[model samples]
Target: MGVIKKIFNKSRPSNEKDGIFFDEMKKLLGFKPIALSHYRRAFTHRSSNKTDAQGNPINYERLEFLGDAMLGSVIAAHLFTEAPTGDEGYLTKMRSKIVSREHLNELGRDLDLISWVESNVAPQHFGENIHGNLFEAFIGAIYLDRGFTYCEKFIHKKVIGPYVDIARLEGKVISYKSLLIEWCQKEKKKFHFEVYEDNGVEGQKYFGVRLKIDGNVIAKARATSKKKSEEKASQRAYFALQEKINIK
Candidate 1:
């Protein structure tokens, strides 16, 4: 609470704006931001055919990069301070889990980050990474517009406070493909995923699926959400390959 207050130190009386973004900020943050431009850039998708006066793409990609670094640094510092006994490798792995693309995507999606995204591309056409990328970009904007201290505080508030449920995240499987890759490496088995289109009925919708395994179709899944379908297929593939893998 103190962290967030310090970040958005300015207090103001409501003047006019009454929308979800403002409302959400008021409900969650209790203060209207002094700078809306930074927040707008946070959710700006690259697909939007928008550019700055310098002809640079006006999107969140750069912001995402900056945010990613800031996030990693803050998280690493936190882990370093909290886990005094953890070695470098342990810290690296823990940080990876925390700042992972998959995890960030979930955080962004769960927070409805897309709701504020400014884009020319149809929202449905966006890939899964958009959520995570926007999240990172937003963080970067916060850092640049504010400062490291404010950025860290905002992350702890918006990220760690509401979403960093450590126990669940520990047991949560972020990437089935990663697991399958590790398993294959340990088992010395060749594996790959074969993706193909799966056109739906006349009125439904088009979709795709991938068959993955150790030189065999051990798992098959389809979904309107390609990532979900891929993850499902990967999960099946993981189960099939699990027996062959030895955990060192």
Candidate 2:
């Protein structure tokens, strides 16, 4: 009898940890999840090295891709309805602003979603981008667990309701670098972002960029990455030439 009981217990699934996860997810999702397995996959990091019976690796990357598509669809629909007068370019720009990676990272951090991640890598080693990736995965999980309606509702409640504002978003610049380049092209002025130096302590290195317009240095900036430094320089150049650019 003891041996039989032991075998039975060993084969049984544990509920204690899953119950805690369910409650936490309920609070975050604003509804009880019908399928917990999907949510579990959402929070799973690639480093966990988990796999399914079919030998397919399980992680949030696939979910993230699906969520990206869902988010684009829903946000595009909302933009279409809200801005009836907007042309294709206008609507696209607005949607981009709303679903920008920076905005997604902010949303994920607001929810403290990183706390639920399952991974072999230490939390401290993760980059800021993980937050946005997790948020997208969470949305993908929602879509799979409850369908499009529930997924749309979650996005509306968490993203569109709280953050999106048409007026504010219109003036928002998704990429100052792009804006600066456009302005320079229109004005028939040549512009360049040159890496001047790389500086910083061992683990933390900063790249310096100089923005030159028509052979004249316009702005100089430094950041952790060359791309970031170039963007910073471009932003500074834009502000400096704001009057000339006539940007609204």
Candidate 3:
């Protein structure tokens, strides 16, 4: 209570905009922030060209790195406690599923974290990965302002409580491409993903991939990038050969 009051006092907004931000952050975090500056830094983009008094760049990249470490540590500890029977490999894989880029991006989108971004670049120009980046930077801000206890609490409330289902996660496939490759290796079958062609209009180019298995084309797919096209092709191939692959 005393600490909360002190933090609230220290973080009181001096202006209308600051007040709105403070309230919004309080709503998002479920607690008043000790230092609003950390979150401001979290939302700062490199394109904004922001710098601190000492001429150090001020952007969310460093906070994203810190938050990533914090997320891994907290999630790992939870997995360690919850899955005692899981080996190192199993634990690592499960953690990956929970903290997957897709999952983080979903979380960020749900929270509408991107709305707070301070960037010179237009929002339409930002890629899908920016959502996940903002989410990680937000976590980093929580860690900086409130410490590990608050960080753990926020993650638990927002992440673990809702999404960390062991049974569901165990069956979730993080990468169909990896799964297809592993199945092929296990069955002693040669598999390849080849970029067959580039498609789409100017400024929206797409790559076409052919997934070949044992000299025959298993599946083909097109996407904005080679990696995405290959993944899509692998996914199609996996479904085409689902019975034969029999991933378990």
Candidate 4:
């Protein structure tokens, strides 16, 4: 109780603007915030370089880590009960797909979490990952401010109920490169990915990948990383051979 009171007292919004902000937050969260500091830290970017009274660096990164674990735990439990017939490998794959970076980024975008971020850096300069990181940090804040039950409820409402359709998830491919490779091997098709360093605009070094199937270039792509370039190339290849890929 003393700790909770201290947190509330330390950063209680001191203006009408803060009051209105809390009201909006209440509507979004479905509860009055007991520790507004947690949510504030959740939305704070590392660019702010904030520190607590104890001089410990405070940002959303740590909260994001905790939230990731919480999300995985809840999702794993759900999968375990929903698919009793699934073996260890199957369950693990499903969880990976559900908690994938792409999916989390989508969820964060859906929530418009970026608008709430407090940062010294320009919002436009931030990467696509900022959205997902904020969402995870928000979940961590919820867990700390409320409890595991509220955290689970939020996950169920936002993640499980709307997004996690078991049948649809089973067919979902989290990595296009892996899927493409699997298809190639299964079809006994000779495939190779030749990756080369290709520097681009602003002198930024990039990787160019050309995907060859049976000695023919199926797709070519470039990205900041070899793996990303390969994945991009695989995505194009998957679309080109969508009919043969046998995925709907």
Candidate 5:
């Protein structure tokens, strides 16, 4: 069944030159591919305004959903099989940490997924989530194009093997705010965040914050809301404490 799909894909014409996509795909995937359309759609950003005959948008979003599921399933299975002594809560948190958005964005950025996006929207304007979204979408494309076994192979090779560093990531905090709070609490320091209205960007309400620790203004940051602003402020504080923090 998969072989038949491959032949049909080979017969199809592409606006871009042949072998170029295939070769690039090989380098990116670390293996030569039998079909190219799946990758083309994988890389195609929603901004391109493309759709298929069934009126389904020919973007990576749907595939991203599928890939996200696949990733979660695979990661869960790995955790279950390997960590025999780990409890459910431990496994769940570990899985969440592994599949976190920040991690996914890092993977996508490292893979240079942005270069292949076919968006009408300027890549510069994209939000932080774009990288993670595209990464998931790319996974979806691989799953559909090659089926489950190959999808597992790709995820294991690209995601699990290369990126999932267990011990290092275990001590990592996905939220800078939590780390900052813990530091303040442990050091017995009086810390507070002051938020002020941005009064700019009519449609979006922005907030600015200053994180003061031990009567010392450690960082100032801004974001769409008070929470985001505080998180950003906390992140700044964490970076400022680069030399001090245990980072464990």
Candidate 6:
């Protein structure tokens, strides 16, 4: 137990560094963190694989889980009240679009959250998902340190007030593949995807996809997964055929 405590203490920043972190937190959250440990844990990446005195793993994953729930609950309530005329399905779908991984990642990037991440691994090695995960963990930390009221305020200021627009979001298509497929069906045009392995960089295997519309290759894309490649291809195809799709 004493050894674990010593290890944790050793990993913590110096007094000067602590001051810098405190100022950074105040700037980011608009409030001082009463318990800096919570914020520390929020920024700690699993690449560090830290552990506590009782052999419990210490990282942001648990905090990320909590923040995800809190974010969903707050967003769901906002959607429910803001769009009273929307049916259950409509509200649910809208919430999904708002809190989508892509959107969260964008939010994190805008906040420059990765600069604060404490990780043993190089930032370049981390996936884009890390940005959203860190954002959720940071939100979880806010809820833990400041309670739900302050957390809600932060969400309103950061998420709802700036980014969310009901009319714009209503017309936004979260899934390019879905939109493309729907358009093709309505236009009586055939569409299909040819997927295959196309490993390239990082010694990591990737999937490549070619999107075909009306038996013509419309676009090609590659990603770490088949679905992602297909989605990328679909997005490209959508832009290429946006005029036609929007017309129809």
Indicate which candidate wins on lDDT.
Answer: 3
* Clashing pairs for predicted structure model 2, backbone only: none
The TM-scores, one per candidate, come to 0.59, 0.64, 0.66, 0.64, 0.64, 0.64
lDDT of 3 by residue, 1-248 (tens): 67765857576677898899998999999888878899999999899999989999999999999999999999999999999999999999999999999989867865779899999999978899998999999999999898999999999888886557686588766777898888889889999888888865677576889999999999987666889778767766776685565664
What ranges in model 4 sit over 4 Å off? 2-15, 172-248
Q: Count the backbone clashes (under 3 Å) in each candidate.
A: 2, 0, 0, 0, 1, 0
TM-score of 6: 0.64
Per-residue error (Å), model 2, residue 13: 11
lDDT of each: 0.70, 0.84, 0.86, 0.82, 0.77, 0.82
lDDT string, candidate 6, 99-218, tens digits = 999989867765778898889999888898887888899899999887888788889977886567676589765777888888888888999999755666665557789999878999
Give candidate 1 misplaced runs (Cα > 4 Å). 1-32, 162-248
Winning model by TM-score: 3
- Candidate 3 regions exceeding 4 Å error are 1-11, 172-248
TM-score, candidate number 3: 0.66
Considering lDDT, which of the candidate structures 1 and 2 is the better prediction for this target? Answer: 2
Q: Candidate 1: lDDT over CA atoms?
A: 0.70
Candidate 5 lDDT over 1-248, as tens digits, reads 76776665564335467657776887777655666788898888778889899998888878889989988888888888877888999899989998899889867865769888888888778787888988898888877777777778888887776556454467655777887788778877788998755857666466789999887898887666789778767866776676576633
Task: Show where candidate 5 strays beyond 4 Å.
Answer: 2-16, 172-248
- Which wins on lDDT, candidate 2 or candidate 4? 2
Residue-level lDDT of model 4, residues 1-248, one tens digit each, is 98865665455366787777677677677666777778889999999989999999889999999999899999999999999999999999999999999989867865778888988999878898988898899999989988888889889977886567676577656777888888888888888999755666464456789999999999887666788778778877886786465644
